[model samples]
Target chain A: MATQSFKTYFGRNSRQGLWYVPLLITVVGAVILTVYTDDFASPQNLSNLLSQAMPLIIVAIGQMIVIVIGGMDLSVGAIISLTTALLALDAPAFVLVPAVFAITALIGLVNGYSIVKLNVHPIIATLSVQFIVVGFARILRPVAGGSVPDIVVSCVAGTVFGIPLTVFWAVIVLLLGWKLIHGSRYGLHLFAIGGGVSSGQEDAAHNFGISDQRNVILAYVCSALFAALAGFYIAGRISSGDPGVGETFALDSVTAVAIGGTQLSGGIGSLHGTLFGAILMVLLSNGMNLANLSAFLQGAIKGAILLLVVSLQSRKKMGL
Target chain B: MGAIAANPVLQRAIRVPPAYLVFAVLLITLWVTKPQLMNVNVMGIFIRQVAPLGILVLGQLLVMRVRSIDLSGAGVLLVVNYMISSGIMGDVPAIAYIAMALSVGLAVGLVNGYLVGRRRVSAVIATLAVTVILTGIIQFLASGKPPGDMPGYFNDIYNTKIWIVPTPVAFWLLLTVLMSLFLSRFVFGRFIAAIGENPTASHFSGVPVERTVIASHILASVIASVAALVQSASVAVGSIRLGLEMPIDAVAATILGGVIFGRGDGGVWGPFFGVMCFALLFVVMTSFGVPDPGKQIARGLIILLAAIFYGLSSSEK
Candidate 1:
């Protein structure tokens, strides 16, 4: 049923395949806004849009990996909360900054071990971690008032060649994602582990000596590191460490990746699409804000879009 | 610990549901430290506090038994909560509110069922998205304005007691009993068990897998509305934030009751005690003068422990 629809929709030499669906939607959405609203393509609006996507882009990088690995990390947002809290704590940047990555990586290891070694379901394990970390984040700073060092601010906030400093960071992370997943032989193994595994064949990747467990652990570790970077940048942008910041990154990243055309059930995804997907999501929100839409209404729109993306994407792959 | 758990006698006892053990330990601690809490009347007041959650679990377990999950209870609770507290239906009778809440729940549940059962969307993602949509709708409708007070008529119904038990607690108990009977005596129970054990097998065996799953979701949402009604009444003054955590708590309580995801090994009594354990836990924590943050931490720890225990049990199997 799905194949018939796909062939009809994309035509015979569909090089880009279904990835073009999200790209088309994003372009159409942007085109409508540009024509209807004068300031939609203004310099200020464009810059603001790119900057808004900075932190989310980083978080989505991590989420893309986990989604590819057939697992999820609900604690991603919590890790951001924890990172900012630690960054805001009473300590020098030299001492506290490294602590953020180390601790997040350690937490990621724990998350990975629980899922891989202890055999806990990814959702259950990560959700429990979410509760633990969220409570701790709140407890650490009930009110958001922690100072971010000036040096850290300049590093993440200062611009390069008149563009946002964070955009540079975004580009770097994007390249890294591309290289890791689409370049190296190791990357092919990562995809092999998630993709082409017969259903319920838990160790099918093992037959290829792909080391599924190691790759799963690596996926989580990368997620934590990327989330830490996002938290660091957010703190720098705000000039304060906020426990409340990045609270939506966990689920929103899932939404963004899905919109970018990544399958939630693992395997068959590309970060290239995720990058545009994140931009599209932020653009929609930003566009609505400029339109003077109510925040409440925006929430509804976002949720509805998330549902649509998850369900509609499967129309040809797993047909509803 | 493994050796002890591996013992045949211990295995049978462990299968009795760990909620009892936790309840016993907590109750004993309370007995020694705050014997005043042992009074039946006092216990009734505390039990009333968690009756809503107790009711929600009945639905959660049913959905889980059919190898699906209902995370949309919070969404139903919020919408019903907004309706009653927002006074959108001003000057209406209590039955009107009740009907509206149940209907709202039924609508949401049917959507969830159709999405998961027919469309084959993942249960977690569908239900979660439903919650987000409902939350957004409530937020949009409220428009940053706090909700007004709940009508007094519902509160009166909430307060009414037959004998010493509060009306809400009694309602919860009655529902639990009815659910047990429904699952045990009816053909639906067979469908649930068959589907839960093996969905494909159940389908091949002519168990009407899709219908059973959808029916369970419908039941879950309707019951969640009942829970929401009780919750809104207890507060009297409406708050938008009441039910956000209830679904997660319901899942935790269900797990602690020994009903792992897609399995109903503990039965209703275990979850009954699971809800009791939560009530007692709050009582004990409050008595000990633990602050709200501390209680939140303890709650997280309990959930993590449950997850860890589940891992242990599954790995052992």
Candidate 2:
């Protein structure tokens, strides 16, 4: 029955249906906002939404890659929190940023090592990493007192000719990420790893195949790298590194990735989809604020929309 | 097969659960550094405080074994804590209060089960979404106020001791025993193990895989609600943020207890000891004047160790 329904939908171009639903939801959301608030489509709000979403988009893109390779990086939020705290302690931008990036990469290596050598599931493994990093974050800057250097903040926060600095960073991260995944041999290897690493190389003659173990580690490193970068952006935005600020991003990033149609079970998805999902999420949150919904209600609304999107994605993949 | 038995040295090293050993080492270090810290009377209150988290871990471990998770416990804890203190069930008998709380837990669990089991939703996402909704609903209801003074009677009961042990501790031990018996002696126990090991195979073998998974989740939620009541009763006043860390902490403690995804070795006893380990950790930290942030770091490190232990164990298997 599921196959029959899937075939019927495909016969009518079901792939097109995916785009329509999210688009329709966005349109309806826009309409509702326009009806309710005079500043619904104002230029400032539009820019603010994208700017607010930029960090999450970077993180989501990273998360999307890891998830596609059949793993998760639960420590991204903690990494961001830790990096933000680190950035606050008056270290030079040149030294601090690179140091944080390296530390994050080390964490990713630890995560990858545990997943590959120790054989722990991604959920438990990443969750533990999150705990450790969050704890370290508190230890580093228990409160929101440390101010990121003005120079660094200005760089991240400044506009580039008409484009927001954050937007520019997003574009750079997206292009680099896309090229790595679509342009390089590493990309093909990742697909092979996700497709069943053992079989893909064992059966094929054209194997530029690195071990699945290596891919897993690299994926986690990438996740941490992006998360740390996002942390820098967040520190810029807040002007002060807050220990607890990155707390919500754990759930939000997951929701964004899932909404972008990345299967939680892994082996499928595109960074492009994640980019759209992040935009939609930011817009939705902005729309909710305009609607005068409470912060708590806004969260619930995000989760519900996430549920609908993920379910739709899963169902389509299940050929239902 | 050769790796399993040929390495006698490796086998010896792997015999005992690492967390338990770590707990012992930490305990001894603390005892030596501050001889007065190990006294039962001094440590008892702190142990009692973490009992709520320990109980929540038991439920968390069970769900995790079935290859599922429940972030909704925090939300369930928040709402149930509110219900008990809100005067919503005004002047209800103590037993009735307990019953009402349990029912609320079961209801939330039912919804969670339907989404995860029947609907085939991602367990983490589904439970997380439920948590989001529940958190919102509770916040909307409370208008962001501490719900009410936890009825005085609950505080009295929670604090009471049997012989030397606190009531909550005793209650946890009893529940663990009953849970162990239920899992080991009953058909349901076998079903749970079978389902966790391989859901598809269990289904093929005539087990009601979905039903077992759902039932475990519901049972786990019910246990969490009970923990919330005990937790709320321990506190003098209610707060909106009560039990916010229960889910993650429980996950940590449970993992420490030797229950990793779809496999449990330490069983009830393992998690029971894990809770005791947490209790002792707090005692040690406070005695040494490690400060709050230091304590958080310690807790996180312990959790990380548990994750490492899980990875090591599964790979060996």
Candidate 3:
């Protein structure tokens, strides 16, 4: 957390500077917003910021996993919507929150099956899931429904030492993700599969005693779980099961993962970067909001930022 | 069983694309269950609804043929719709509106082409960014209020009928036929096929791979402009949210037509039928009293089915 550590960490004028772009953005965005308004940069305000960004961070973690596996999921947002709808319709009654998570994992399993077993393109397969899941959500609740259970609400919004419990949830994801990805052979296999995405890297990993398909499937299942959790968080925040809450998450999560310096082409990046990337995205929009920019203009700014960041990162990869 | 599986003629017939089969099934189902629904007047009106999608598929197929995609059609359609309907051009003549609308497509398409083809950006990211930018620009301009109505002349063209078929449907069919013919007869079509088969090999063979990609994007946009005009005219009023579904629908239809990225075994008419399948799906859903959400579910299933079909075909190859 010190500038002294940063000095040795990323030397000036390094070719690998793209890896630090998201971190730089987070710093710059925070500074600019803090300068613009006294409300920003405060501990409470920062806590509020983390709470607001918690769901996307969780969702982006899932996305980051999928990207590490050399694929994408257009359905994560819809999965969130579907799970929330399940909770809205049956929570405190028929379907439990655990059941919602189960259903979401099942959906993710289906997505993985289609891609790995059925040989469907990841984009196409997940897109179909997106549509089906979103449609199912609408069917479950044609309109936003009743509030979530009180326990569910407190579980996310509750505080630990004046910080949102949601922050702890995000931290758990990051910490667990790090161990799962970096500390174990499974992570190594995942990165290997990503390195040879669609080129039979699975076979290579298989020779390494890693069940490639299972890992791919696990990545998807993890993503769906987080998305469903995001739905839980959103349902708590809004106090309703609005099927439309996740309209922006699909692209936004992918954008976060991409900006975090994860290779869209696979075989690069870290959970830490994705975590920072999600914060940067959320902070960018939050800063724009504090600036009192029009909602329309804010959208343009976010879009431009996403486009600019990704292109820059990709350009670096191309040695441009 | 071996003979049945291996018979060349039977195999050829089976390979004639699934969209046609879906169309036939829907038509027969309607004939048996609700003959009254099959009448030209009833079908014509519904078919008109998909004419824009049919046209958009033309462009979708072209770029997709070059191993790239253009989701920016939705963006192009949005900007053109806003321009023609918002009266931003202020009472321009109909032809002038047409020109302006197409120019928007050309402009957006060119940017998409340059980024994807020249700058080597991923087609999905580049085109997706273009859509984001256009949406932002329009949202900024509208500033939260609903846009105004389009000209009466546009609506008149939308609803017009020529000899039992709606004008839009006729236009759609003509475009389909012309595109099919063009792909068969033109040099650019050969270029598209070459680039799609293998960009590096095609380039080494002097196929002008990069230019073909950029040209395909430009052409796709021009075709998308026509679709936008048809769509804007259909709604009659300038609406803020329109044409977002076209990109997905266009991709689905193209895939349903057996036109995977960089491959097109299902010629243009196959996708024309793909468009009709959507039209027919609506009729079937409507007759069954399936609501909007149900229709959405059906659409998703079709896309999934198309993906499954693409997977099967690609692996078989």
Candidate 4:
């Protein structure tokens, strides 16, 4: 019985995916880092790592939402960049914060509408949006300079009852992600839609009365919202808006989602898997930085890791 | 909407590639607005600027026809540029440099093919990852050793003209003609058409689907490398910060030319004019005094509009 249960948990065909594999790798990686480096176990470094990993974890969770429905959003990085730019505009905190979310929602809506109504491919649609958004961001703030609202900064940097705010940030984001991805019927519909897509039956979920189009659109919205949240967090940390700040988040979020044992072909994944995957990426970078590895080499290594991880996951479709 | 789509005249118009129409429109716009700039010498320079992109598009349309993509051109371009300009290759003859660049293209192409065609990985992620790896390596090398000046011969070759047409422009035209002939007159063209129409049906009918896709990728990468050589030659010095816009522009031009993933309705000349559209677009933008950010927005808008055109038409069909 135990063997059967174990097989189901880690099996290739499981809906949970091979998530345990990354979890295992994360554990092994953490142990190795602790043993090898004097600074790895320090509270300061550990906290720093959490803070560094937070934005990615958030963005990956958003990416996971879209990937779950056999779609992608390359515009997330641009959305994040735009968010920071807007926040840094000389405005009141209350006005800037809501304005950011509203703008991102509209962007997501357009992305969803393009994919659903106009029948544009997900990558092409998102890529065009990415360029458009980035153009606007660059126009708004050519370089990174203007200060963010004071309230946003304090929320991210302040401690709560002797615990760092990043810890609270982690708990809240994870809880929300878990609720949206696992605890809701909407999440189930996303899987149904993605399963149909990967299986080459685009209408299977719709046949079941799932309203797949609306769900897919909502998923894109959530993705944009999460990216905006990540942008907000970064704006707080940096205390200023940088037009190019979120340039890498699009690919990084995709890498994180894929590493979490989430199939890029869609239909199978777990929140914990994504969490572990984000942690693994952060861990690898942390260890590499401590070892004095060149930043460029570290980038190449990360790319290799993404390549290796994706190659292992078999898929049905042949194109992007 | 349905009634309009059903009209025979509209249907026929839709079948015609948008590239030709856009090219004509832009040409007329240019002739009317900037009559002085329409001369051969001035026009030749503008067209020559897009020769590298035009060459890259030839490969892009081939792969897209077979339902795959390659975003790794930037990486290949960066590496080739680095090799020639970094002087790390250490005074190699120009021929030797050309051979080395082609070899690098061949290697990257083979890897992309193996992953996309055989392993069935998403072509976007695979090629994008390859680009990231190449970019990282180039950055690392450049950081350790600063980039140096290009050999003067490349610029000389780049500047030469054949009967008032620049050498690069002539070269780009030759490649396009060769590509068009290869696709229309050869068995490989038939294979590409069959595969694009239906991979499974083509495979069952004895077409080597995987081999063809792999070959297409290898050819595309090699073509991109040649474009890179020209691009590197056009510049006076090597820099690590090569624009990533080339591959994306290639995609835009290919789509604007009417060759989308798994469909090659536009054929060679359609995309040829598509490249011409870009050439004219720059002139128009320059005359209008559009800034860099506006140009970026225009690029994005063009791709979106062209894709939507195809998307709407295809869905209607």
Candidate 5:
């Protein structure tokens, strides 16, 4: 009976997944970094770290929503790039900001419609969209030097009442993510749909009276919206638009979600786990930089980590 | 829509790979607008430029047939390019270079096969991670070194012609033929087809599904290495810039040829023509003065439209 309970807690089929494992790893990693590096414990460095990790955490939370339904979104990076470009245009804050959200929602709608209605595969659909979006972004900005609205820049620059404004951003984003992934009926429905899709019964959730198609579409839209939010934050921080700024976020967010113990096959993940995953990635990078490791070698190490983490989570299906 | 779906002729046309249609359309467009550029020598030069891509598509089609994919071609191309150009191998003979390149390909292929076939990881993530790792290592090694010149022999071989066709173009065609024959004549071909149709059914029917997938991945990686050799030879010097676009183009071309996950309606020649379409596309875009971003958008649109065509057709069936 004890073994059965333990298995239920950590089994491959468990809905919660082994999320605590990443939490444990994150704590351990943080402790090690704190001990080994003098700068890690400093207040300024900690604040900088929070800001540095905020965008990824925001993006990963959104990515986890789609992964829970057994779909991948490769266009998030491009959407982020497009967001910055749109924001950097010589326009008012109100117009530019709303326009960014509207454009991203439209992109998300097309992505969701292609996969859900047109029967295109998620990866291929989003990959094609990625190219198209990036091309448009390049046409808009071409290179990285355009000024953002003053209000946009100020949102990320200063502290609020002895605390960094980044802390407030994290709190807001995390609450929103938590509500979407853990607090709402839609979140439960997403897991139900993903559970069915991963088990080779693509219609299981639909048979249970869940509007699976709409939910899946919404998930993609949410993912895109989150990417846009991250792009907004990045643009504010940099005070400019860059066509290539978000190039790594798509893969990086995937890595963060996967490291958090979410099954890429779907239906098993946690918001806390994703938070820890993003933190772990940022921590690893920070520690590496402090250790004076070669920047190029850091990429290889991260790749190895991704491979190692994914290899441990075995799945039934073999292909893309 | 219902009427079109019910028509026999329309059904037959839908079943045909779009690559052939696109190829014909592009050929006519070129012939009509730029008749002078339609000569054999000019076309040969254009076709030769895409020989590496054409070769890469052969491997891509094989893996896609079995419902897997290999995006590590870019990494393999980069590593091989670095090896030949960086002179990191310490003054090796030509045969030694060939051996090293093949060995590297073999090693990468085995890792990919193990990860995707045995470990059952997502093929995209596994192969993409492999690419990142390889690219990172190459960049690290080539950090302080300047781009180096290629051995003169490679350029010489690249320029050679066989009966008015560039050697690389002929070689690409020869490989495509060999691939077609191998798929038609060997038991392995049957294995791949069965696995693609249904993995569980193939397993119950006593097919070695895992082994077959692994073998296909190995072959694909080795073939990608050969493509890399051709790509490296075409360039005069080695630089650290990533050729990530090549594998993506190969994926687009393969899909254009009617080869999606677990399907191969176009076979080898369809993708051969798909590569031909790309050659004409570049020429057309250049002559029209389309910028780089425009070309990127065009490439994306082509892939999207082609995949949508297959998706609709498959669903109808």
Candidate 6:
């Protein structure tokens, strides 16, 4: 009876004990870094690491929202590419930034329409959209040039009361994203839809609720918006846009989401877990570089870790 | 009956694929625009280049029919290509080299099959992870340098022609014919069809569900290895990179051949013709002097079209 109760409490669906693994990964990474590099303990090193993590963190946040709705948005990479291209354009910042954001949202809307109205699987639909958007980005800007103003870069790179400006902005985005996902009626529907669409629809019908179309749209919009934000940060980091910048974002974002304890089948994950996953990934990359590991071996290691985390989550889901 | 047979829509539905139709239209258009593009030799050469992709698609379609995918083609290609050019065999006879390469491929296939079929990992994720690991192993082994030369025998085989057609193209067609016979005539083929249509029902009927799936993956990976060999022989050297476009292209072409996830009754020959369509597409594009970036865009659009087509078909079903 005691074992049964203990199993019940610690079993797969429980969220209370979820923070342990991610926190462990983070602590282990930091300790290993400190041990390996003398400069790793310095404030500069920590700040630099956060800055490096900024883009992926933003993308992961967006990816988590989509995953929560039981779908993936592979088009996030294309959004990043498009936004980066927009940033590199010679147009004024006010025009360029807002236009890029709007364009990204529009692309998300198209994705939502195809998935919701046309009843397409998220993976295939988003993957196709990714291709189209990437094609457009290439056609529009074949060359990877143009620049972000130094002033804007300095502001993003600057610190507010010893906290990085990017960190502050990231916090705001995180809060807004969390509230939108966890607090709203839309959030409830998103989770429901992911759990099972037929039952979800029945539940919504009973409650005098509307279709989850709006939630789907919001999720994709958030994904594209966050991807664009990451693009802007990337622009600031490089002070220019390159088509190749987004080539790795799609795979890495998926990896981050998976490692975050989010089920690829959807509806069983958290932003906090995702944040942990992203940090773990960045730390692994940093550690690999520090250890002078070959890029291919690093890739192998990352893939192994991702496979392990996902398998653990899946096994738990399967009640194994 | 003759008029009905000649009707365009019936012709389309009964005859090969719309991709072939498009390929035909484009080929003719190019020929009319530039008569210089109508050489038989040029067309044969172009068809020969895409033979590897054609072979890979057979494996892809087989697995996809069972509601699985194999994106590990690129990794298999990388490793196999590397082995051929690495001089690892070091003066071993050609048959020995061939045997070793196929074994490596079959080993990889076995691993993928176990993970996906037995462990019940998501097909996309499992195959993709396999691909990543294989690619990494190849890259790690190769380090940063270009790979060494393929064996003289590999080059010799690649360069061989029977009559006017390339040996690889002939091999590709022979494999397709054999696969068609297996899928259409054999008991295992029937079992595959049954399993693909509905796994649970097939299992209840004692169709050896797990074994069928595992074998399908094994066959798919072996085909990919063959593709890698042909690809390496054609290039005469292996590099860190080879055929990243292949798995996705295989997906696209399979769909274009009307072999979507749920419906593959269109059979193996349809995708065989789809490979010809891709071959023709490259011919048309090159004839028009379309640049590399333009080719990229075209490929992207084709993939999108396949996805959209898949969406349309599935929703209707």
Candidate number achieving the greatest lDDT relative to the actual structure: 4
State how far residue B277 of model 5 sits from its true place (Å): 1.0
Itemize residue pairs with steric clashes in candidate 5.
Answer: none
DockQ of 6: 0.35
Q: In angstroms, how far off is A54's CA in candidate 6?
A: 1.3
Worst 10 residues of 3 chain B by lDDT: B1-10
The CAPRI category of model 6 is acceptable
What does the i-RMS of model 5 come to? Answer: 0.9
Question: In candidate 1, what are the lDDT values of residues A76-121, reduced to their tens digit?
Answer: 9988887887788888889988888998998889788888877776
Candidate 2 residue-wise lDDT at A280: 78
Residue-wise C-alpha lDDT for candidate 5, range B132-170, written one tens digit per residue: 899888888988354598888998999999999999999
TM-score of each: 0.94, 0.90, 0.93, 0.97, 0.97, 0.91
Candidate 3 docking DockQ: 0.50
Residue pair clashes in candidate 4:
none
Fnat per predicted structure, each in turn: 0.43, 0.43, 0.54, 0.74, 0.73, 0.31
TM-score of 1: 0.94
Which residue pairs show backbone clashes in model 2?
Answer: A118-B311, A120-B311
lDDT of 5 by residue, A130-220 (tens): 9999999999999998999999988988988989899999999999998988889999999999899888899999999999999999999
lDDT of 3 by residue, B250-272 (tens): 98888888787777878788788
> Which has the higher TM-score value, candidate number 4 or candidate number 6?
4
Per-residue lDDT of candidate 6, residues A209-243 (tens digit): 54777778778888988999888888877887777
Each prediction's DockQ? 0.47, 0.46, 0.50, 0.80, 0.79, 0.35
Candidate that would win on DockQ: 4
In model 6, where do residues sit more than 4 Å from their true spots? Answer: A1-11, A15-19, A140-143, A150-155, A197-210, A315-320, B1-17
- Winner of 4 and 6 under DockQ: 4
- Mark the regions of model 3 whose C-alpha exceeds 4 Å error after superposition: A1-17, A93-95, A161-163, A198-210, A315-320, B1-14
Give me the runs in candidate 1 sitting further than 4 Å from their true place. Answer: A1-17, A42-44, A196-198, A315-320, B1-6
Root-mean-square deviation of every model: 3.5, 4.3, 3.5, 1.6, 1.9, 4.4
